[model samples]
Target chain A: MTQTSKKPAAVEALGLTKIYGSGNTEVIAMKEVSLSLARGEVVALLGPSGAGKSTFLTAIGLINPPTAGRIVIGGEAVMDGPRALVDLRAFRRRHLGFVFQKANLIPFLKAVENVAIAMEINDVSPRAARKRALELLDYLGVGDRARNLPDALSGGQQQRVAVARALANQPSLILADEPTAALDSHRGRQVMELFRQVAHEHGSAVIVVTHDHRSLDVFDRTYEMEDGELGAKHSPPAPTANSTPSA
Target chain B: MNLAAKDIRHNLGRFVLTAIGIGLLLMTVLGMSGIYRGMVDDAMVVVDRIGADLWVVQHDTRGPFAEISRVPANLEHRVRAVPGVASARSFVSHNVQREHRDEPLRMNVHGLAWPEDNGAWVTLTAGRPLGQAHYELIADASLGLALGEKLKLGKDTYTVVGIAKGMVSSGGDGLAFFTTQDALAIQVDLPGDALRLERAARVQRAVAQDLGQVQPLLLERGAGMASGIPALGPPMVSAITVRVAEGVDAAQVAATIAAWPDVSVHTRDDQEALLVRGMIDKARRQIGLFRVLLVVISTIIMALILYTLTLDKIHDIAMLKLMGARNPMIAGLILQQALLLGALGYGIAWVLGGWVFPRFPRRVLITSEDLWALAVVVAIISVFASLLGIWKAMRVEPNKVLA
Candidate 1:
């Protein structure tokens, strides 16, 4: 029998700890959190307010580093407890993507330009970046709205454009926080399924911090977080186990 | 690809309004400097046009413009006799204010040596210079005296035979050129009542003196025969302008004239320095203060404007940072906008200055050097103003996008 070799992990965090202040002022935002995501995995992080889901996402995204942890992305160590084995900002530019609750598209840039700017910021040539941006927008089903400014787009369209922007650089990991919170259930499910489709087709890992348990079936796996601690992961069909959160 | 340009396009209305506001302020600053240059140029006009190598004035005094100067009318003859002297002419200038067509007309009357000078060196923009001695004169165009127009000065009516442009005093009063005799007569002429009072005073003085009491008939004769008979000796002249012979050192002629105990001598350059450093020093300082104050106000306004603009884009900046945009890219957004604002404002100032400065009451002369200097200063101000915006942008945390 032939044996297929295991693919490399997309992102890995070991013993991640984040404490806000010292002694009397201290508040541990996240404690001993560890997770390893395989390529083509779409995971939903279900948590309540102040549950450290965003904190963990930011830490792994290299936006805000943890007080104690090791982060390895694409099988390469990037952060050793925030010591930065690599140029963190440059590394993030080339390797990570983010989507926020709001579309957060640059108001001045058109839909296509919003996506193109992401690659251009990472040193891609404008022409090539623009071409790739158009392709990503087409892939995300917003190609027809490429010329519209963010203000002119509907909420669902804007989210799709934001996703195109996130995928502009072909990053190894995509992190999203409440990306579909403002959309209706149908559009919300559509966005969650789009994330799953992006992960599967683009071979990138995606971790979404969401309160909408209605779209849990679209996720490959789901983890619940509370009081700054992440619970055990549960596969689909256990969506009711993690209750839907307040908007 | 240029984020600054895109952002400006997105908010063009506000940016243009801000630029215009800055432009008007910068125009004031430019106009102030231009006025200073014009004043200095006006002050030097007479000095330069006189074409004299040396000026001989009253002893121990800076004269002609800086202070009052008086020397014998024959000082020209004395200066002419000096070694290396080419020629000499008497120069007398004094201001006259009189009613012209219901308007108060102020003029700085300059005396030309008649047969020797003929106001030939004066640059006429219209008509001709003095055709003959006595009442024929050359009036600056600014004096509003048309060619062939008659202007009454004292007892005599002088005809304006020529019109010169930009010939004015340091005080900006237009210049009128006349023969030395006519100028002297105008200087000494008194009103009818003042003349009668002066004659009575002279007769009284004569009665008090032994000679006057013995010669009462002589006093009466003197009163009737022009009481203005050089009573304090020969009529005095303001100064003597001397030209040195070709290949003859002006400093040598000046040094020789300086040795005279009764009079002082200044080289042309010395006279110019005296005028600039003495006559209008306070005015220059006041104008300079206004210019600097306007610049400071411009800087503050720009800084505040840029800071507010940064505030408006705080969320966008955070989003860009979270997207991994470098510091240079983020800071460039603000800095480029500032530089663009400065360029646009400067351009507007130049255009507005061209349209408005000529209409100013006083001459406003903007030179190429002044323009270049102002451009450099504006660029520096733009960079400095953008610092506040750049600082705020730099401090923006990428994680704020998540929040």
Candidate 2:
């Protein structure tokens, strides 16, 4: 029988720690948290405020770096034990995308420009970037609002534009920090469902830090974070006399 | 879209207000420079209009405006006798104020030896030059006097025979030209009270030498007639101006005449340099200092505005950072905005200055060279002012967007 090699996970984090201050004032924001996600996985992170969910997201996103950790994305080690293995800025620009609590679109830029600038910064031709932006806007259902400035857009439409911008560069990972906290329940649920669709359709892993639990059912897997610790919501039961578990 | 234009369009109201504010400051700077230019021009106008190749002043003095220059009126003939001298004229210049229509009217009085063969060099805007020198004056139109109006000087009333435009003293006072006799009378004659006071003091002093005895000479002719003594008669001129012969070097002729005691000689270029660098130099420095201060203040204001504007959009900057914008890209945004504001202000101020400065009481000259120089200055200011905003933008943390 022929053996087939398994693909590397899309995202892998091991022993991620983020300690703020030092000595007497030291506070550990993340304590040796480890997580992994496969490509096309849509994972929801549910946590209380200051539960290290943001820290973990930022760490994996290569923004606020982990105090000690190794992070590998798409089989490439980007960080090793608090040291960046590659140029963080270049790596982030090419591989990572983010959506914030607020839409955070540049007020001066129209929706299409907001999306196009991401690709423009990555050295793509302006015409090609703009075309890509238009296509993404169409996919995100905001093509009609492409010419509208952020101030002219509704809250839901602006969030949709922000999502299009995050996906503009075709990043390997999409990290969202409370993206739907400002939206209505119906809109928030719709946004969560859209993230799932984006992850499967675009073949990108997605991590969403959300306080709203109503959209948990939309995620392929869910994680709970409390006091800087992370654990999966569903784990295999421990081995018993009549129980067995697969490796 | 260019980020600066987009930002300006998005906040058009605030951007325009800031530009207008900066424009007002730049206007002050440009206006000061214009005023300084006017002052320098005013100082040289009479000197240039005199049509003189050389000026003879007091030996140690700079000139009329820079110093008091007095020479004997007979020096005209001596100057005319110089080898290269074409013609020489005695000039008397003084400032006086008289009562006119119940208001004090101050004017610059010029005395020129109007020759029979058309010696007047300054242009006449409306009327002819001095046909009859005595009791006939050439007046500046800015004095609010009619062409044929009579102006009183000393004990005589002179009719305005000619109207000249833009003829004025270094101090911007309106001018009147008369013959040497009238200017002498205006310069030497004391007022009624002053004359009476002087006679009284002289009588007292004469009688003081001899106690209780007023001499017949004292009563007859104020005591000077007793000893066959003579009275001072011939009038002294302010200066002598000389025109050089066609083939003569003015500086060489001036150097020869400059050796005479109590007679300082200056070529035309020398006189111009004296008036510009010597007299108007102070005003120029004052304007220069003022321009620098205003530019500094404007720079500070621009920097503050840019910093505040950047601070207002700090979250957006962090979003850009999180989108992987380099520091230079973020700095470029702030810098471009500053440059836009500066260019707007400079353009508005330059346009308004050209329109408004002409209406000012003083002549305001705005040249393309000055505009170009100001453009460069504004460009430097804009770049320098944007540094503060650049610093703030560079320090922004991408994780702030995550938070």
Candidate 3:
């Protein structure tokens, strides 16, 4: 799992390092972190608080640039040591999707609008974007809640809508930061299984930063992080019935 | 779908209330301009109605309106003998205050030369122009005088023969028109005891002079004749209003009259300029300052409102940025909201003005040009006010969403 894929990897980060301040105030957030993920795979990142998991995730997400690193997505070198080879904002818009713990759906927009806007900003036609958004919501089992606002939806339903929004642009990489932290055990496992299903079926790579270990078996591989360094990966457990939705 | 429109729909109550608040402010700004127009219009009302080609006043004076001007009553005869003169009539004006029906009544009295000037040019809303040489007057409707109403001024009771509309002096007092003889009578009328005191004083003054000492019998004859009798041929008038021949240039006629050292000559345009610029210059400046101050206050208020609204949406803004929304798109949201607010407020101001302006003590005249200019100014203000909100939105860090 540590070796690079023969087929083009969906995400490849080489010796990524992030440093904050210098001299007396110098602090290193992440040190020489390398990660690779094949297409159609879901990976779990587990860590204690302030262990640099978020720093590493943000670096790969192109939101926060690493001080020294090479980031390649879909076989193209996008970021080189805090310098961007392409327009980072446009690249992020067209190729990456993000889901936060709070769902982060625009409060004023309905569920379908929230998802459709993600694709529309990428220059997709409104009608096609809406149609794709509805289809994604249906695939995630939140089709009936398409007209509801974020506040009107339950915790599990809101997370499902968020997932549908992340899949709106058919992105190559999906990054989720503790997406299930606000949900109960039953709802949290349901969200984690949805990520696995999204990766396996849509041929996109998925990485979830989570503290919950009860649903780690849903991922294809797991990596524990501490002291700003990523540990060795662990093999996934056998398929369990709990991975499937109860309802 | 328009993001700004959707947000407004989401919070329609707050948006509408905000627009109403802005509308009242805009109304005050618009009213300042209206009041300025009203002042200018009011100051020129009498000057316009007279329709004189040239005005002959006391030498070196701007008046009959801007300053007090008095010339000999027979100046019209001299002005008529000038080349290109069509007709000239004596005019006299003064302000009178007295009690009528237990309420204090104030009017600017204009005396028209009888036979030669019947006040036919005055626009009448009711009743006919002066039909008699005495005891008949035309009063502006602003004075609350009705047609055929008898008003007692001095010892004579004058009948309201006509009613005029929008006829007011530069000071906003309603105008009343009467024949020169009747107006002079009202000026000279006095109480019996005061008349006796004046005659005794006139006799004493004559006795002090050599003529009175040599002819005491002549002084006694003059005292018995009338109170303060001077035996002058006629009373002096305020000015002479001249109408030149149709084909004759008024300025040339005015220049001819100006050559006479006894009186100053002003063409109709010059008279209007003097009334507007010299009479109401301070009022104009005061209104202009108020208009500018209101616009500045409106801009600041709008900026603060927009800034507060932007703060309310910081979380949403950060989320949009993370979702890859462009800076222009985000900025457009704030700009559209500001413009909508301005448009709504402007509309409400017009509606409010329509209901309220007619009731004002002074006239409020609104021109189409003024309306269009205000609209353009409001649009510009909206854009400027949105800048503060746009700056705040641009500084939002997308990484904040993850935290």
User: Best candidate, lDDT-wise?
Assistant: 1
lDDT of 1 at A201: 83
Query: Per-residue lDDT for A1-247 in model 2, tens only?
Result: 1111134478888888999999999999998888887778878888899999999999999987899978998889999867899988888889888888899999889999999989887888889999999999898888999999998998988988988888888888999999999999777866777787888888788999999877777777778888888865643223334221110
For this target, which candidate reaches the highest TM-score against the unseen true structure?
A: 3
Question: Candidate 1 or 2, higher DockQ?
Answer: 1
Runs of candidate 3 exceeding 4 Å displacement: A1-7, A245-247, B184-194, B221-233
Candidate 1 per-residue C-alpha lDDT over B118-219 given as tens digits, one digit per residue, 9 for 90 to 100: 887888998887878788989998899998888887888988899998887889899999998888888778889997887788777788889887866768
Q: Write the per-residue lDDT of candidate 3 for residues A14-42, one digit (tens) a residue.
A: 99999999999988998888888888888
Chain A TM-scores of each predicted structure, in the order given, are: 0.92, 0.91, 0.96
Q: For candidate 2, lDDT tens digit of each residue in B202-320? A: 66766777732545565445533222323433457888989999999888899889888868887778888987788778778988999999999999999999999999879888988
Candidate 3 docking band: medium
lDDT of 3: 0.87
**How would you class the docking of model 2?**
medium
Model 1 clashing residue pairs (backbone): none
Task: Please tell me what DockQ candidate 2 reaches.
Answer: 0.57
Model 1: how far residue A41 lies from native, Å = 0.6
lDDT of 3 at B313: 86
